[model samples]
Target: MTKQLLKPDYIFESSWEVCNKVGGIYTVLSTRAKTLQAAFPDRIFFIGPDVWRGKENPLFTEDESALRLWREHVKNEGLDVRVGRWNIPGHPISILVDFSPFYNQKNEIYTQAWLDYQVDSLHAYGDYDEASMFSYAAGKVVESFYRYYLSAQDKVIYQAHEWMTGLGALYVQKKVPEIATVFTTHATSIGRSIAGNNKPLYDYLFAYNGDQMAQELNMQSKHSIEKQTAHHVDCFTTVSEITNNECRELLDKSADVVLMNGFEDDFVPEKSDFASKRKHAREVMLRIANKLLGTQLDDDTLIIGTSGRYEFKNKGINVYLEALNRLTRDKNLKKNVLAFINVPGWVGEAREDLLERMNSDQNYTTPLKVPFITHWLHNMTHDQVLDMLKYLNMSNAADTKVKVIFVPCYLDGKDGILNESYYDLLIGMDLSVYPSYYEPWGYTPLESVAFHVPTITTDLAGFGLWVNSVTGHEGTLQDGVKVIHRTDYNYSEVADTIKDTVSDFSALSDQEITQIREHAASIAEKALWKHFIQYYYEAYDIALRNAEKRMKKQ
Candidate 1:
């Protein structure tokens, strides 16, 4: 017989990315917040580190009157917190805790953790201390709130995200045994380290010992906390099937549920607005490209792009450059290709010359000095993209049919160059390519398809695997996304495939391109939070049941 599912009376979710837009986790939490809020309303609370203290946080709005009694109580108890609402579609109740005070008691906390949960922190360094302090503070906040507000009869689920919050989950598990805890690892610490270190992660995943590798790589503390938390949590979860395998091999535990990342359509512009935005985006891109390259890139020019974190090897930035270089040399290329690397780097400042040209009415058909990059970088000699371009001798010359531009700054709508947000610029692209070598859950490619831009990714990406499953065949740009089969040894083959794909896409008719865009949007519609939120519910049920079982034994 199927057991009755236990629903949560109160849900407390904590993450380092709560109100902080650092990486893919921010996308996961921010997009899914509305669905959770609708289900629990005021009962759901999000706890995050108060990194924006004494500053304006665009993603959050503070309310002095919220949780006044509990705020005063926690303040008296030496806990510093700011109660506010996250400025997202859901506007859920958010508590940003000041964890700086806990740094003084770090040794005591680590010692207790090592004794109780076998989490090794002796080798910890860098951000580990700060993240742990915040985690401990988050745990204290949950403990205090639970003691004053919740009853023993209430079913509570406290979910922590990534290793940054593992210590907090462990603390919650130990102090509040009655509360169910769920820990979700987006990617294993050792797994990412192995891949980033240029090791064959997939081929040697089963052979390598996670603990041994952690010691070798000086990642013992982070790995230890992640592993111990997975084993100790009421329910251990991951974002995708790819990461579930990583967890099994590295952490020696399997996920109770796979909570796949989902997107919300609320961010997408309506039909009429989307058309106008696309037109404006194309105009801005072409205007800048023309100014920098000293060429008149017409409306027919194929505008393609790739954007993500600047992990040169892991994000396949190297492969992308090689492919673009190959495409430039391809004689069969039918259209003018204006490819962009939207990845941010340590930028010095926007090009004042380019800015002057853009601001003025005169259309100069002369290339700017250092024409390949939109902004000046702090360490131009050391930058990977510049080094690769120099090595390949890609000058973005006046006669070259294929030109590449490096946008080395964040597209936060305030960056001096584009002066538009990432998504705003994204809608203007004809096609997008990620081709990631070590992506856990590729939000870039997924976001690309969501914006009706056909994307090229790799089977190595979690989103690619999901796309293949949905299409019932290997993905292609014709079908809205191309999932190139990638292995550690097939770098050249991947580059060749990307070149051929771009060539073929450029040859397609306008009607054909529109059809492909429609297909891309359809795939994105299937991945909305409405369809994927059930996995979270399943995770919550598992945590609740496991917590009930543990409490009964206690």
Candidate 2:
């Protein structure tokens, strides 16, 4: 015997990264949109903050004619919103709300939030007010739309991602009790704060009190809202098992379901053109490095990369640099490794001298003064990557076998140095490493494998843990993704293992490399949305059933 699942007639999802390209959340939502659209075409609505008011947002396409009646009704409800289509694969409907007016009413809004739900705002700081305003505005938009267009008979669902949008989910839960609400904490605030502050998160997770940590880390408001939303939503969900543990120990609740992040393979080049794409990416990347360092690196150079948010210790940029520095002393390392740190930082501008040299056809024997960095950083001495490079004595000298280049700007195809986008150049790498310490679900390593580039990640990453589970063992390069065992205390050991892995990978034959590349693609294929969407369906079912039960009680 089996039970029929309750499916929603309409779904509304809210997130800060809906149109704004900040980090991994954008990738998670944008890639997942087409799949959701296929299931419920024209019924899925994505709400985002209208941060680009009076400016051009290339990621969004606005059509004033879209949902004209609803737009009229929403404007009358005191919401300044734009109905547009997200310029992604599926081109889903998007609403960008102007949340500026809510700033003026924040005191009243905070009071209401406190009365309805115990969301503490006394200690809120930095981006807290801005994110909460947008979240509340989004909730109002959904409530107005539901009141105007939907009925109690309609199966409606609202989902909020991250703590920035938690208030919105709580708001909808109270104001529109008929609509099912879900709160997904990609990573809990206290857990991330503990990890960012260099505290051992997993070892002492159970012993640490969430409220005490919030006070110590100056994160009371954010943690308070996150904790309340997890407990109040019709369904609470998270992205990975590791983060679920954080929810249990820190937030005093567990996720009803774990919705693993899935990759959409439509972005990858076809088999007929992958080789050419890889070649072009490699040529562009090598030319930039050679022109800047005054060294010629041929196609045989082992180009490695590690990129993510510029969290020095959390994203393991420090550890990656340490491993690269240690690899210089490894006698078994036979190949010349040219590594890249593609994390964006406080970039002042592109180097005019490098641009001028790149335009020149002549070859110069002398390297630039600071040959390590691609861009001129706002704080050159204070930048962590450059500081670590100087500490490790990794200057790009003439005879240095391992040359590291720090690209401290986002590669959005317009960074003045590498005109190619991040993915456009990502295909070139011989190996990729994302040894993240605080990653929930690492998109960098997953994206690398999708491009047929063998990647090395650690067990701390959700993707790394998932890979190890699928293979039934911690794998090596032959398995396409090498999952290294990383803990809070094993920094030096992780660096040594990465150095040895890179050294060993360099010695493989051409045939072995091809097989490994194929295996990596297979791993990515298994992680596509077709397989992962079931989790989201399960979440919707739980939310709808709980909502029905609540309505029955009313």
Candidate 3:
């Protein structure tokens, strides 16, 4: 029989992505909030930075009536915070702290941190100060909130996400000894730096010393905070087993639990609404593609996409592009492939000529002067995507068998060109691809699968590994996912596999494709928060139990 779990009376979760949409962390927190809310109800609180102090944030809905006295109490305690509910599912109680005031005391905060935990903030640069200040302020917020609202007798757990919030977690450990703490690192700073620098990370993984690598790569401050947080917290958790190995090797501290990321699929259209929405999405996608490329693409044309942060190497944009280029030359290809690079760039604006053409609704056989992108970039010459396309000569010419378009902006329903939310368009895709090399928990591929679009991801991604584990083998496109094997030196081979997968997918019978889409949705259903939230409870259990022991010792 399994052991009984310790549950907290109150939970305080802090993340840089609480009301912000920076990357995959946003999806991780937002999608899982409903399940957390259901479990904890009014007792769970989320703390985040007040980055939008003057301006309004669409993701946040503030309610002055919710925490009426706590708002005044926090301000009187020398912290400016907004007590409200996050605008996402469940509308979880949110506290957005204005970290700007803490910048004046950054040096003092750093000194205290160094004295307490030996964190090396001396080499800080760029986002270090900002993130640290926000973390410190969040810590103060929790301290103030606890002292006023929560009692020492109440069992409380504070969970912090990523190294960006490490200082806050460490602060809570020091200032609020009565509260249990959990620190989760989505991805290690040194690991990402190592991969971003084009170093062979996995090939020489065992040979590398994390401290030495940190020093060599200018990641001393980030590594210090992350390492110290992981070591000091009551519970240290990571997202996946791959990352668990990373923690053991790099931080020299193994995670107490692997909290695999999960999502709630309520955002997905209902079965009654899915068909009409999907059809409308397809119509819009096809019309835009036809207008941009000036080619009359049939409804049978394959619409595939790869979207995430524009990390050319880490997110596998280079390999995805290479695969698309190779697909153009495949003699056995059955359908016209329209591949979209939906990663945002430094966009100048939507292409006026293309927008004008789209508005006219007139047929044009000739392509635009720049048919490869939907938006004008600030530095078109400096952009990696355009530069790579130029190198591969994968222009969307009228005669080309495969056409590539770069949607270099967030698809949040108002990009001027594709006035549709990403999910609205995501459901239209025949296939989605996220071949990330450094992914801890790949949410884009997961989101794609959740939307009933079959996705191709590499085993290096946490989502792909989970798929393999669930399916009991490497997944196939027919199984609604294709888990390609990727490594330090298998770029060319991985590209070829993607090309093959896409080619094979494009040729599948309509009934077979429908079955695959159904399969993909089923796989996604297995990954829902209802199934994976157990690990989070397990983390809470370990923290609470440990905290109880520590309290007794104190």
Candidate 4:
């Protein structure tokens, strides 16, 4: 037998929380850990911010020499304090960071100006100091950790995640020229910041806080530091082609390849008998109606659903609402349709204000189409919502047959709503709506398909673009999913599309519904975690190749 080619050692890493998630990066690290470990056990390592000790982490190593060296280096350099290590299964040496300097001051206003900048950052960039400071602190922490923790005998490769950890890889490479550095940007600063900004770039950056933001983007600052970090890395990877373009144009870094993000397979629930779940959901819906609206649902009404955070403009909540109003006014749909909205917002006083105004309308009557939005503001229990629905069904004011529910908050167990309730509602849904103006990639449509539920997502979403490319053209649109192209269109047209789509859905026969569900399930099975894992392997291979080339040159 010919000798088997030895696989190169690999290190898939980041500088964020792995098991304890602060953001999307955490999901990325945790989800792919097992697969990467299994494929390259001899050579693979997943590193992150090391921030635990003793029983807190399973890899509670008493490697006193490494620890002692790390302490000396940290003290000498006056580097911010963050310590912890958790080894990955299969991989002999895997780690995560726990920089207490950054994690501890997560809420502290390091500077009054920075705190002011944080608020502006939130509105303009959809990020806060937690992410901003982490980039700088993670870099310092990673650099210190490498100096003290790494062994000279060990052949090493480095991979950093997003802009936060990008600096970490660069710092390590400077000392160990023999090692190769890889940088992966799930989203670019320009892509997420400038493109996603509510205001025009010139207005937000140059006109408003131009001077302060300029300081923030200085040569030594995190923004510019991120750009330099990319330059120092041997290979650069982005999550999408769009992101690649933004990085090159904005950050001025050349990219080596694109590695799209993936989902975990196990998190997706199994497809069960939806009919039974739908029946229970309807009962719960009715009970909620009784408690919130003092009425009951009727069979004649059609339930339309939408759920997400309270970003009305970007998430298309206004677009959804406009469609609902138009659908409500349609003469043919007057008695046949109802809208169920679950977008979260300032449910407290704002919800009451909206309801009070609606209730005061001369045309308004008792047994409202939706229960009191206040129930959401109060953070009512899920069982409480169910009980309220049951009460509404018992009330004569509600038709008990009408189909509709609007949940104006995020669904969590503590909120008393299980995902099962949402899943059941989705199974019974006439349609699920998502018209996001700006989404890195949407998970809702993919999930909707897995549940055999039809959904609508805009071309703006990463998943939507992928699905359109996969499904449109050669096939008729009917397989339980319909992608409505927003294509940089106006608001009115979007509203019309939603209204028209709902009308079309109402007209579909049983055969078409079955086709839609089947298509959705087919799409989900292929697009889910099974397909996403390959990217990790490809990224790992590329990183190692770059590392080996460096070794040979030395």
RMSD values, in order shown: 1.1, 1.1, 1.2, 8.7
Instruction: State the lDDT at 113 in candidate 3.
Output: 94
Candidates, ranked, TM-score: 1, 2, 3, 4
Per-residue C-alpha lDDT of model 3 across residues 390-420, encoded as one tens digit per residue? 9998778888889998999999999999899
- lDDT, candidate 3, equals 0.92
Clash count list over all predictions: 0, 0, 0, 32
- TM-score for predicted model 4 compared with the true structure: 0.70
Report lDDT (Cα) of residue 82, candidate 3.
87
Better of 1 and 4 by TM-score: 1
Against the unseen true structure, what C-alpha lDDT does each candidate score? 0.93, 0.93, 0.92, 0.56
TM-score for every candidate vs. truth?
0.98, 0.98, 0.98, 0.70
Residues 356-421, model 2: lDDT tens digits: 988998777889989998899989989999999999988888688789999998888999988889
Point out where model 4 deviates above 4 Å.
1-8, 15-17, 22-27, 41-96, 102-157, 199-222, 253-255, 271-275, 298-301, 331-338, 346-408, 417-430, 472-477, 548-554
Cα lDDT of model 4 by residue, 130-201, tens digit: 444544454555555555555545445567777666545654565565555778876655444443455443
After superposition, the stretches of candidate 3 with alpha carbons farther than 4 Å from their true spots are none
Instruction: Give candidate 1's error at residue 33 in angstroms.
Output: 0.5
